[model samples]
Target: MVEIEKRNSILEVGAGGGYLLNHAMQRKKKNAQYIATDLTEAMIKVMCQRSNLEALKIFYAGINLFLLMKLKIL
Candidate 1:
């Protein structure tokens, strides 16, 4: 079996909607802190509203650092 620490932290950048973080909270070990950061306050607000987990931390910063993502779409 895979052993895990009692405390954990997951930081998701450009975490729009926070779907992955939401699922991670359910599957990961206890005492894990989920931090979701997005490029806009709108996205973060929406994510916080959609999320039922009280431990989730939502933060926003206006930065687009996804060069690879833009290239992929182009």
Candidate 2:
């Protein structure tokens, strides 16, 4: 299991409908930030419809920029 800290920033790539992200957010600290990105606009729209995710920062991107940056490819 992943433990979220008070100042942690959580990013979820390919978050389809945000099922896992939503649950993870529940365990996050109040000051923690959650960002979810998906390849399709439909999935982002679906995530936006969830009341529990209203405060979530969502975006639509073709690829996982964070992963690429971690791998030093970006």
Estimate, for each residue in 2-62, the C-alpha lDDT of model 1 and write its tens digit: 2223436555677776666556555555655555566665666566667643322333384
lDDT on C-alpha atoms for all candidate structures? 0.49, 0.55
lDDT of 2 by residue, 1-74 (tens): 66765536777777777778657666777666666666666666676666333433333374422220111111
What does candidate 1 score on TM?
0.56
Model 1 residue runs over 4 Å out of place are 1-7, 53-74
RMSD of each: 11.2, 8.7
The superposed Cα distance between candidate 2 and the true structure at residue 28, in angstroms, equals 0.2
CA shift of 43, model 1, Å: 0.6
Going through the candidates in the order shown, the clash numbers are 0, 0
Number of the top lDDT candidate:
2
TM-score for all predictions? 0.56, 0.63
